[model samples]
Target: MGVAYSVGEVDHLYTFFVQWSPNIYRKRNNKSSSEKDMATKKTVSNSKASKKWEIITVKDSKRRLSLCSSVDSEAEEYQEEDDALPVLSDHSQLLDDHHLLKLAAHMPPRTRGYRWHLVYSTAIHGSSLKTLYRNMAGLDSPVLLVIKDVQKKVFGAFSSDPFKVSKYCYGTGETFLFSFNPDFQQYRWSGENSYFVSGNLESLQIGGGGDGFALWLDADLYHGASFSCPTFKNAPLSTHEDFIIQDVEVWTVQS
Candidate 1:
């Protein structure tokens, strides 16, 4: 026969069982429960980190796009600005026809003896013909004389020195006459606006024994002029019948 345990011993055993049960349960749950908790925490942290990274990437991308857009806009604006201005060639094309026609009218009338004529005119405000002549004195075949007529209200000689005559002529008036020897070999040119008339004085070159002489006339003397190598009879002591003119060439230097 076996003896039964006392009540105190039984109570103690039940208490120990209760405590042991909890320890065993804790040991069993530790592997999966602790791992699950760690996974959840890692997931939450990773999610937060990923969201932060995405925000940064998005902001950086937007910033870069904005910068690229601004640059493109600036370039377009510059192109538009450039397009709005007139080109140099276009401005030249738009010159006043009246001015050109007037210059054409100033051309010395065609004569039987003259070969060619080139004419130019410029306002006195910018450059002086005399200065231009001085600059062009060393070029090949320079103008023999440059007649200057200052149409301005001022009355003063353009140049008083006679030595300066070799290059240019200056005067205070409305019209001036220029005579040039095409035979010159060296002339250096300067200035902006001028008129040139070129023709061969074939008869003038022959020297004497001609029906008429070449004459340069200022028709309006004050505002306009005409040059012609007219044919006239050759007679002694006659003001009009002295020499004949022929064959002129006018050209600009390219060098």
Candidate 2:
């Protein structure tokens, strides 16, 4: 969800252009007939909303790219309000502007405009897995779990659903692991198994295959492990398979 801007607050709305491929999320977020029509018309019509954004689609024939341009108006006077940067929660210890930009590029379109709310952080909350679970109790939106290891490597997972203690793993394919070893790399589902994420009192696990997990955090929230898993086909997330957690944070991806 975007920040609601009143009409008189801004004169011109700049367009937000996103380059995407149709087949990238083929199995997820299937488009409905109405959505197809909206794409064909190159506009997203929300008559009920007080502020309407017109989405213009530009196709790149050579690359078959789908470019979305969302603009409120084409007025000459440009305003910075419409293009406000994502508002990070207060005193984030893990994320910086560069990291946020890279992660946002791969995030789902619906979550583009909203601010990220810091729901849990070891820096704020105590370093306990139960405390992390308690913080995410009833959240229904997507969550980004970031971890910094003792070696100073930053990595984590993006949960399509909020983390919960469940007997059976529960999350959509949108759940994926990511690592930033100076450079950012994300691992999406490989369709090998449905074990996207599972949480228990003892541990939290993301991805599973070959008797190993893509990412695992123990109950203390101090010990962590990463391995190559069939679910995401991802390599170890840390410098080593086993790592000591320096800090952890969970941010709700508002939409």
Candidate 3:
């Protein structure tokens, strides 16, 4: 028999986005029908993930994507394998889809050329933000938070630190915000890294740790206060043009 698994694996793992889709995960979240309906309504009104995020899967060396969260899909688990095995996959085309998740054509100089590497995505094996945070906690890498407002304006922040739940902090001022305005076909990033974190952070009921990184678009900036990083000294998230976050994603930067 041919080797059960073993193909091309990246010599390096980079920062990547794990596209989380709320639509595909509710089925297994153990919510009542009515609760799910309410959640569905809330998600629809606030998130575009179901409509935009493509379904992703972690695969084996045979190029078979796993429907389960088995160890084979985890690159980190494969690091112990013998040498010269790059871990090839027939799913290489799927790799290109990372482009759709790009926050900007170019990352800030401070970012030092980091990319969003897929890790704990919601579309796979019922993963969600709760899972994302749990998986991300150990890595402690910088993260890029992307939010799509109800107005269709896509913007985000690059936090110098990984996300964590807190009632009182969002990290140091090593963060900045960016906007991807399709209407203007322009990308905008704030000028400095003065943004920080402040306020109550709850674990997400569906996914994630509900840490301060969580977004409640409807709440006032400082009240929900997951983030304190404002582009300007006075322009808190509440006053930003895209104040209402319809959907959100967190990408861990590898380098």
Question: What overall lDDT, based on C-alpha atoms, would model 2 receive against the true structure?
Answer: 0.83
Error of 1 at 207 (Å): 14
For lDDT, candidate 1 versus 3, the one ahead is 3
lDDT tens per residue, model 1, 210-250: 23212221212122122222211111211222222111112
Q: Report the lDDT tens digits of candidate 3 across residue range 105-144.
A: 3444454445455544323413244554565667766766
Error of 1 at 206 (Å): 17
Per-residue lDDT value at 127 in model 1: 33
Estimate every model's Cα lDDT from 0 to 1. Answer: 0.31, 0.83, 0.43
Between 2 and 3, whose lDDT is larger? 2
Q: Give TM per candidate.
A: 0.18, 0.67, 0.39
Task: Tell me the lDDT of candidate 1.
Answer: 0.31
Clashes of each: 28, 1, 26
After superposing candidate 1 on the true structure, give the runs of residues whose Cα lies further than 4 Å from its correct spot. 1-128, 141-222, 231-251
The ten-residue window of minimal lDDT in model 1 covers: 152-161
